[model samples]
Target: MSDTTTNGAADAAQAPQIKMNVLAQFIRDMSFENILAQKGTGGETQPDVQVQVNLDARKRTPDHQFEVVMKLKVDSKAKGSGDQLFLMELEYGGVFHIENVPDEQIHPFLLIECPRMLFPFVRRIVADVTRDGGFPPLNLETIDFVSLYRNEMMRRQAATVPADDSASA
Candidate 1:
């Protein structure tokens, strides 16, 4: 084979390749609570709804697989009474088979891309469960996993910095 042809084949073999295979997807845990059920439906005033979201991922031992979990907590409280209205907490997870990814890129692949694949399903479940519980369906906004991951990295970096060096020496 010519030198140029040989080098072309070698380059192709070394090129980076990535794949996401969902071996299984399931809800690790989920709960919905209507604390004010007996108190009757909310009045003309709309309740304040608060939401918190978290994403975490880990590699399964002795394998190239990983598990990613996304948690969403929604709390709605009456505007005036402050009495509890409804609370929904969901923990959604998926088992992923990742291969041919470099070590430096694995983290983002798991945290950003994996949960991305799972977000729509989780969103649907939240809406359905809330509707079934008698409240208006809660459709969560589309999450930007990339932004979340970057913010987490920034927080971690800040945490590692020494605090108040003047006090040390």
Candidate 2:
């Protein structure tokens, strides 16, 4: 009984604890164009908005520090005329200090968890830009990071798999 208890205590002590900190976050680049105003087509038309998100992560100069970038493209068009109302592109980045995560997991951690920490700031900026660009505030819905990560993995896998040419016969 004493040996078992000692082994359990030792196992607990040897387990690594995960730690993560956001060192800094900022908008690397951003642009907002009000196409409606440009075209002088100022009418009370219904607007349809679509947003696309992409993420990238890379190791920085420091061994433990990583940089993660989230790219967002938003386009709004008049529902009836199919004309662009506005277009916004934003690239937001965050520097993170992560420790004790397994090597295999670091990729997912950087892509998923790091972006989650920076998402609120990204959302706020998007809303502010749209409102300032002469449109109503466009609040974004919550994003599912896990689903996004899984989808990206699936996409990459599909790209790498070779198609069977024998099927042409």
Candidate 3:
């Protein structure tokens, strides 16, 4: 009994503790183009806006640090002519500290949880940039990271699987 207890205590001391933190955050890239500015001043009606979002994350050189980025591209066009009114591109990223997580779980943690923490900041930046570009503030809707991750997983799997022509023949 005494030997077992001593061994358990020794094992506990050697195990790394689980922890995570946001070390830094920044706007990696930002661009706002009022495409209409160069064109003649014509009375154009309200423009329709389309926003696209993409996410990427990677483990940093250090074993426990990671970088997560959210990229947004917003294009606004005149409803009638389909002429671009404005084009905005934003890339925001954060450095995160994560320790003692299992290797199998790292991808999900970085893709889902890390992005959730960083989304609000990125959203605010997007809104501010649009407002500054002579348009109303564009607030982005909340994203479901879990669903996005699952869909991405499915896409990767589908890409790897070769299409079966055996059945058709």
Highest lDDT: give the candidate number. 2
Cα RMSD, each candidate: 3.3, 2.7, 5.0
Predicted structure with the largest TM-score when compared to the true one = 2
**Clashing pairs in model 3, backbone N/Cα/C closer than 3 A:** none
> Lowest-lDDT window of 10 residues in candidate 1?
160-169
Error of 3 at 54 (Å): 1.8
lDDT of 3 by residue, 71-158 (tens): 8898989898898888999899999999888999999999899899998998898888888877788888998999989999998888
Give per-residue CA lDDT, model 2, range 1-169, as digits (tens).
9999999999998998898999999899999999999988796879999999999999999979999999999999989889999999999999999999999999999989998999999999999989998898899998899999999999887766645444554
Candidate 1 off by > 4 Å: 1-14, 38-41, 163-169
All models: lDDT? 0.88, 0.93, 0.87
lDDT of 3: 0.87
TM-score of each: 0.84, 0.90, 0.80
Q: Candidate 3: list runs displaced more than 4 Å.
A: 1-18, 42-44, 163-169
